[model samples]
Target: MDIYDEIEIEDFTFDPELKIFQHPCPCGDRFAITLDDLVDGEDIAVCPSCSLMVKVIFEPEDLEEFLED
Candidate 1:
């Protein structure tokens, strides 16, 4: 399937402790992707409880700030 939405990295909640980014999904679950994944050029976050997924719109530099957190 295609992405459910295109969300900015700024709109997502970054968990410094977990080093993951999260956003609410319409399926009552959260979309999640790890910092490592982003660093590796990954941009898709998927919701574990459903088939929906979101495309995380960001550049490599966008992850620089989160690197310290």
Candidate 2:
């Protein structure tokens, strides 16, 4: 089973910096993301070339520090 299946996502967002490391889509596309527009179960990224959406799942603890700030 996917790790994302076990957690309850409170929010979702995209990291523009992370986009730099994203591999090109099979169609040779690239994309960027921001943190405010993320959804719980949807892809937070897009393919610059194909415009395909990508989904990212984060653990609850992963966002704890952000919530505290």
Candidate 3:
């Protein structure tokens, strides 16, 4: 359970289809978090294959555009 790093939201690539934010993990997998997760006030992105997690830096208000249906 290692806390990897704190990364800016801008550093993540948002997938409109998946509606998630993605960043490449050093372990070859990806750190991902969904827009719902963000809207729910979550700030951590985790790698599905590993224990690495990163803190996401973003304002809840900043996620308005992504939350739109």
TM-score of each: 0.94, 0.37, 0.89
Candidate 3 runs further than 4 Å off:
none
Candidate 3 lDDT for residue 52: 93
Each model's total of backbone clashes: 0, 5, 0
Predicted structure with the largest lDDT when compared to the true one: 1
Candidate 3, residues 1-69, lDDT tens digits: the string is 467899999999999998999999999999999998998888899999989999999997889877785
CA deviation > 4 Å runs, candidate 2: 1-23, 39-42, 63-69
For model 3 the TM-score comes to 0.89
Among all windows of 10 consecutive residues in model 1, the one with the lowest summed lDDT is 60-69
Assess the local accuracy of residue 18 in candidate 3 as a C-alpha lDDT between 0 and 100: 86
- Runs in model 1 deviating more than 4 A are none
State the lDDT of candidate 2 residue by residue for 1-69, as single tens digits.
122122223333324444222433456654434333332324355666664655545554554454444
Worst lDDT window (10 residues) for model 2? 1-10
The better-scoring model by TM-score among 1 and 3 is: 1
- Backbone clash total, candidate 3: 0
Highest-scoring model, TM-score: 1
Per-residue error for 39 in candidate 2, Å, reads 8.1
User: Residues 1-69, candidate 1, lDDT per residue (tens digit)?
Assistant: 699999999999999999999999998889999999999998999999999999999999999998976
The 0-to-1 C-alpha lDDT of every candidate, in the order given, reads 0.94, 0.42, 0.91
